[model samples]
Target chain A: MEAALPESARGGVAKPSSEADARRRRAFIYGLIAFLLVASLPFLPVNNYIIAAVVRALIFISLGQAWNVVAGIGGLLSLGHGVFLGIGCYTTGILFNQYGIPPWLGVWVGAVLSLLVALVMGSMTLRMRGVFFALATVAASLAMVQISRHFVDLTGGADGLALKFFGNSWWAAQSRTPAPFLYASLAFVTLYYWITRWILNSKLGLEMQAVRDDEVAAAAAGVAVFRTKMLGLLVSAAMTALAAGLYMQFYMAIDPEAAFGLSQAIQLQLPALIGGLGTAWGPIIGGAVMIFLSEVTNWGGTKIGVSGVDILVYGLMLLVVVLYAPKGIVGSVLRNAMKGADR
Target chain B: MNAPAVALEVRNIARNFGGVVALRDVTFSVREGEVVGLIGPNGAGKSTLFEIVSGNIRPSGGRVAYFGRDCTTMASHLRRRAGMCRTFQKVRLFESMTVRQNISVAASQCLPKGRDLGEEVNNILAQMRLEHQAERRPSELTLADRKRVEIGRAIAGHCRLLMLDESLSGLTHDEAEHLIDEIMQLNRARGITVIVVEHVLSVLAAMVQRLVVLHNATVIADGTPSEVAHDPVVIEAYLGTKQKALR
Candidate 1:
C-alpha cells in the first residue's frame, strides 16, 4: 500500500523505524505510569501536612509544564505566567464567593478569562523574542497585580478575598478536607502533563521548536514563527490558569501577593529548570524532587534550630545544577548514561 | 519570452535594519529545471536575497513571485507550503533528531495524505545514503554527513525550487565533488530547479549551468560559467579587483 507513493512519501525507503516514533511510544508508556502514580498519591497513608505540600507542588508543576510550552520548546521566556495563574485563581474565587458558584463552575470561568488574557498577551508580546518578550510578560504580571490590589471592592485588594468552606457542597468544598484537594491537584497536574505531551507531538509543537531553533531558517523553510510563538504562549497561559483554578480550591483565598507574586513565578521555573529545559518529563521530575526537598527541609528545620532553609537550599541547588549540569538532572543523567554506554 | 519561463522571480527586493541596508534592489529569476549558481564576495548580500525570496524578510520595496504569483508578504511557513524550500548556510538539521526523523519531518510537511511517514523517511534516507544512520543524531554525524542530511531534508520536502546557501563551504574536495554529483542527479533525474550558492569554483563549475555573480549588492555578471569567468568586465569589476589580495 505504501509502495504506490512517491519516494518522499514511502517513509524515504531506508530505515526500520524513526526515532520520533520510538520516543512517542516510550513517552506514552511513561505517561501511563505517571498517571497511575499520581492517581495513587491520595491513597498513601501520609500526614495531612505532607499531603498539603504535595498538592501545592503539583499545582506549580502543572503551571511549569504549561510555561514550558513557550519558554522551553518555543524558547520564549514569559515572566508573566503568574498573572494568568492569578487571573484564574481570582476569577474562580470571586465567582464562588459572590455568586455561590461552585469551584468546578468557577474553574471554567477562570479558564475562559485567562484564555482571553493570553490572547491579548500573545498579540502584544509574543512577537518579541527572548528578553524583550520576557520584559513584556513581566510588565503584564506587574500590571495585573496592581489591578488586583487596587480593585478592592471586587478583588479585596492587598488583603485578598477568602472563601469560607462549610464542608457541605461536594465540589465547592473539596478543600475542606486534605484528601479531596490532593486528589484534585493530582488530576490537574496529570491532565496538564498529558495535554503538553500531546501539544509537543502535534504539528504546532514541531513548528514551535523550529521557531526556537532558528526563526529565519524555519521561516525560510516555510514556518510561521509569529503564529507558532503565539500559540505556544496561549497554551502556556491556559495551563497556568488551570493550575491556578486547582490551587484556588486548596487555598480558598486570592491575595495579590500570594497569588500574583514573583515568588510563585520562581516555583514554576524551579521544577522546570531542575528537571530539564526542553524535555517533556522535566517538569514532573523536577516537581517531585522539589517536594522531597521541601519535606526534608521542613522535617530537618523543625528537628534542628535552623529554619527558612528550604528556599536557601533550593537557591543553592539551582546554582549548582545550572552551573555544573546546565541541562538539569534529566539532561545531565542522560548524557552521562549515553557516554557510559558508548564507552 | 513568455514571462521568461521563470519558476521564481524576485523583483526589486530591498530590506533595511534600523538604517543599515541589508539588501537593495535585489532582483533575479530562476527558470524551471535549471541549476543556477549565486556567487558573491563576503557580505555581498547573497543570503539576504535568498531570505527575501523565501519570505524570511519582507522586502521594503518589491515582490517575490513564485509561478507568477506575488508572495512578497507571505509567512515563511505559508511560502514553504507553497513549494519554496531552502537549506541554511550553517547546515540547520534538527540536530537532536535522527537522520530519518529529520527527513521525515521535512517530508511530512509536504507528503500526500494517507501515506506511511516511516516509509517516506526511508526512501529519502536511501537517496542520501543515510539509511544506515537513520537512528543516529546529527550531533553524532560528520560535517559532510550533516550537510548531506540537510540536502536530504530539502529534497524530501517536495521543494520544486531548492535554494542551497553555501552547501559546500567547509567540505573537502572529494566531499564537495560527491555532493555536486548528487545535486546534478537531483536536477537531471527529478527536474528540480536548484539554486546553489557556493565558494568552491571547481565544484560549482561542474554542477551549475549558469552563474550569477554579486558584487556590492548587484548582479555584476550572469551567464555561462565560461563566459562569466572570461568576461573582461567580470575580470575588471569582480575578479581583478580582489584577485591579488585573495591570493
Candidate 2:
C-alpha cells in the first residue's frame, strides 16, 4: 500500500499514506488520555452533585452509543428505541423483585429478551424505509407501553416496580455512594464504545453501511441487506437493554411512563445526533454537552421559579444545533479540520 | 468440438405490469466466455429483461438457468453470490465510501474469512484505472470514473457472468473504446462471460460477438453483429418504413 503513494506527495497530501498512520496514532493517544481521566473521576474529591451528574452523563453516553449502532451506522432511523430499554428495565426489575434474582444475572435475561423482540420487530419493519419505518417503530413502542401498563400483576401498572435495597452489595448492583454507580455506567459506556468500533471494522459493518447508502446497489454487490439490518438491530437492542438495566439498578425504581415514553427515546437519540451520528467519539462529546445543558437549564429554572423552562431551553438548543451544524457537532468539526489539513 | 457450456438460459420469460405487457416469450441463451450485446430503443423492455435475468424482478412465466441449473426464482443477492453480477445504467456506487472501499466491500463478499483485502482492492483499482482516485469518495469522482467504479465493483465480486445495463451510455468515443477493450480483455483473459445492454450501436457492434435486438417486447434479431445489422427486420425497426423503400 505504501508503494502506491507518490514519494513527493506522501507526507503532505491528506490522501492515503503515512498521514493515515499519523492520524491513527494521534487518535489513540487522545483516546487513552480521555479514558484515564474518566476512569479516575470516581477517586477524585468531587461532591455528590458532581458525581450524580457524571453518572447521568455516562448513562446517556451508553444509550447514545447503542442508538448510533442502528441509526447512524446502519441508517435505520428508528424512532422507538425506548421499547428495548423498557424491556431491559422491566425484566431486571421484575426478576429482582419477584424471583429474588440478582441484577447481575437478570441484566443478561433482559438483554436476551430485548434481542428477541428486536429480531421480530426488525424483520417486519426493516423492509420499510424513511417515515414509514419510523412510524412502525413508534407504534411498536406505544403498544409495549400499553401492555406494561395493563399488566398490573407483572408490572405494577402505571405505579411501576421498585427494586428493594439489600444494603451495598455488588451482586445486587446496589450502592450507598454514587461512585460505584458512576463506575458501572462508565464501564458499560466503554464496552458499548468498543462494540461500536468493532462493528465499524467488521464485514457486517461495511455491508450495513452499503445497505444504508443504496439497497439496490448493495444487493447487486452480494450483500444480504435484510440480514445485515437485523444484525444491527439486534446489537443495538441488546446494548440499549443492558444500559436500561443498569439505570434501573442505580435508580431503584422505574415506571412505564419513564421507561417506555417518547421522551426517553428522544433522550436516547439526542446525544448521538448532536455528537455526530456515526463517528466513534461523537456520542461521548454529545453526552457531555447534553448533560451540561440540561443541568444548567434545570438550575436556572429552579432559581427563576419558572415551570417548563428547561423544556423551552432544550427546544431552543436543538433548533440552534440543527440550523448551524446540520451534520452535528463532531461531524462539522472533523470535516473542517480535515479540510484545513488538506490545504 | 464439444459445444460450449451455457452460461445463462432464459426460457419462455414473460413479464406484465397490470394490463401493460413489458415482455413476453423472451428466450435467449448466452454461452460460456461469449460477449453478447442487447440493443433496443427506450421502453423496449431491455432493462426489464436484464432485471429478470439478474433476479431483481420475478418473471411472470419463465425459467432462468445458470450453467444448466434452474435459478428463475432465486433472490438477487443469492444470484450474485452464485457468480452472477450486474451494473446499472445509472451508476450506483456506494456514495459514502471511497473508490477503493467500494471495490473492497464487493470483493470481501467472495473472499473467505481472514484473507488480506489490500492486495485485491489495489488490483481492482489498477484494473479500473482508478488508483489516483482510490481515496476519493464516489461523489467527488467524474461521471465516467463513477461508472468505472461500479464496473470495478461488479468484476471484483465472484463474477462469472456479468450483465451490464447501458454501461457506455454517457462516455466519449475514446472512453467508450477504452472500456470496450477492458471488457474484451476481461472476457478473453479471465473467461468471464458478458451480456452488455448498450444503445450506442457503433460501440456495441465493435465489442460484442453476438447481437440480440428487442422490439415491442420480443426478440427481433439474434445472430452475429454483422448478420443482425444486415437483417431486413432490424433495419426496419431502426429506420421505419422508409428502409423497405430504400432497399
Candidate 3:
C-alpha cells in the first residue's frame, strides 16, 4: 500500500504518466490476442453443432455489448433490451416475408424503429430508480411478447415467421450453413466492441458516468443529465436491433418466445455481468464463458437426468458473481492487476 | 475609477416548500472580481439562494441574471457551460472517478472549443497541488483533499463566477486556512468573481471584501464585512438578541 503512494507524496518529485500508458497498451494487446483466437475458430473443421453453438455465443456477445452501453456505462439497468431485439426481428422478418425487401435494408429500418421505441421507453423510465427502471423494462419486455403473440397476421403469432429461402445470397442474408452467421456474428461483435469503446472514451461517456454516480454532481459539472441518458438508451437499442436482424437472417425464423422472452433477457445481460460491465472486452469474454458454461452444464444435466439444471447453474453463477466479484470476472481481474501495478 | 461590472444579480428571489418559506424577496448583486461572503445562521435560506443562482433549483419568483443576461429559465448545465460554476454544501464528487477524472469531466465540458482538455486538466492538477493524489478516488482522500478536488473541478475551465456553498465546513482550522488560500489565489490571480456561503463569520470576514448577511430568508445587511459586523440590526438577527426574560 505504501508503494502505491506517489513519490511526491513521500517528499520526492512526481512520477511521469508513462506507467499508466504502458498498462493501457498491454491491455490492448491482450484484447487483440483474445479476438484473434476467437476469429480462428471458424477456420477449424468443426461439426455443424459446434459451429452453430459458437455462432450463438457470438450473437449473445453482440447483444451483451449493446446492453453494456446503456446498463453498464450509462448506469440505466434494463431488463427489456429484448424489446428492441423483438422489434428488429419482427420488422426485418415481416418486411422480407411479405414485401420481399432485402434483409440488409430491412435491418436499418429496424434500427430506426428500435430507436423510436427507446426514445419512448427512456422518457418513461430513465428518471426512475435503478430497480424501478429494471422493473419497468421487464414490464416492457413482457408487453412486447404479448404484442408479438397478438399480431398473428404480421408476426405469425406463436408459430413465428420464417424467411423464404433464397439459397445463399448476401442480399437475402441467408446461408445454408451456419458458417456465414459465425463470420457475420464475428463482424457484429467486433463492431459493437469498438462502438462501446468509442462511447466509453467520448465526452458523452464521461458525462453519462458522472450522471450515473451522482445526478446532482453531474448537472453541476455541466452535463445535461436526461439528454445523456436518452442518448445512451438510443444507441444501445439501435445496436440491439441490428444484432436481432442478423439473428433473423441466421435462424431464418422469428418467434415471440425467442425475441422477447425472459431467457433472452438474461442471456443479453450475462455476458457483461459475468465478463465485466462497462468494458468493451467484458461481453466478448463473458459471452464466450456463458456459452461454454451452458454447454458443459447441459451435458452434466443430461447425465444427472435433472430438469432445468442449465438455468439453475446460471442463477448460481449470477449469485456468486454478484456476491464475490461484483465487478465481474474481467473487471475484478483488471482492477487487481492495476492495484498490483500501482504498488 | 470606473465601477466594476455586475457579475451576478439576484432580484426578488422567493421560494417555499409547502407553507414554509425558504427565501423571500431576496436581492443582491456581486461585482466582477470581488470576493463576497454570504454569512447566515441555520435555516437562513442561504443554500437555497445559492441553488437558485446556480440554476440547480428554480425560484418561485423574481429573476437571476448573469452579466445582465436573464438565466432564470436556463438549465444548470447551460449555466455551467456559460461560465457559472458552483460547489455543493455537502461535497459531491463523482465517487467512482479518480480525482484527475473528476476535474477533467468538468474541463472537458466547460473548455472552449479547440482548447486541449488534457492540458487544462494537468494545469488544474498542478495549480491545486493535487498531482500526488490525482489517481486516488474521492473515498480515498481526506476531507480537505476532497474539498480541494471539488474546488479544482469547479475551476477546471473558463470560470467567470464561482458559488461555493459551505465549502469550508468539516475541516480543521489549518486545513480550512489552506483551502481558503487556494480560493483566494483563484480570485486574486484569475480575476474570477466569487460568492461563498459560510457559518464561520470570523474566517469569512478576513477573506471576503464584502458580506451579505441573511437571517430568516431575507437580507438583513449587505456591506463591507466590518460595517455589517458592527451593524446593530445584524447583531440582533445573526448574533442573537441578548434580551433576557424578566423574572
Kindly list the per-residue Cα lDDT of model 1 for residues A1-343, writing each as its tens digit.
0122233332223332455445546656776887776567667776778778877778767877887777887888777678888988999888888888887788778888988987887788666655778887788888988999988988999999888676746857554567777777777776777676665555666666667876765665466678878778777877777778778877878899777688777777888888777666778788888878977987899899888888887887789888988877767865543221110
Model 1 docking tier (incorrect/acceptable/medium/high): acceptable
Candidate with best DockQ: 2
In order of appearance, the predictions have TM-scores of 0.89, 0.93, 0.91
Model 3: lDDT to the true structure: 0.84
lDDT of 3 by residue, A1-343 (tens): 0012223221111234576557666766776786677677778777788888889899999989999999888898888788999899889999999998998999999999999988888888776555877888899899988888998999999998888998988888888888888888989988898888666656777777888898888888888888889988999999999999988888888898888998978888999998888877788888888888888888888898966676777788889889988988777866755431221
In candidate 3 the C-alpha lDDT for residue A231 amounts to 89
* Clash count list over all predictions: 19, 0, 0
* Candidate 1's TM-score on the B chain: 0.91
Q: TM-score (chain B) for model 3?
A: 0.96
From the highest TM-score down, the ranking of the candidates is: 2, 3, 1
Q: Write the per-residue lDDT of candidate 3 for residues B40-148, one digit (tens) a residue.
A: 8899999889899988789999999999999999999899988998999899998877787788778877889887776788789898889888877799999989989
lDDT score, residue B216, model 3? 94
Q: What DockQ do you compute for every candidate structure? A: 0.37, 0.40, 0.38
Compared with the true structure, the alpha-carbon lDDT of candidate 1 equals 0.75
Clash pairs for candidate 3: none
Chain A TM-scores in order: 0.87, 0.90, 0.89
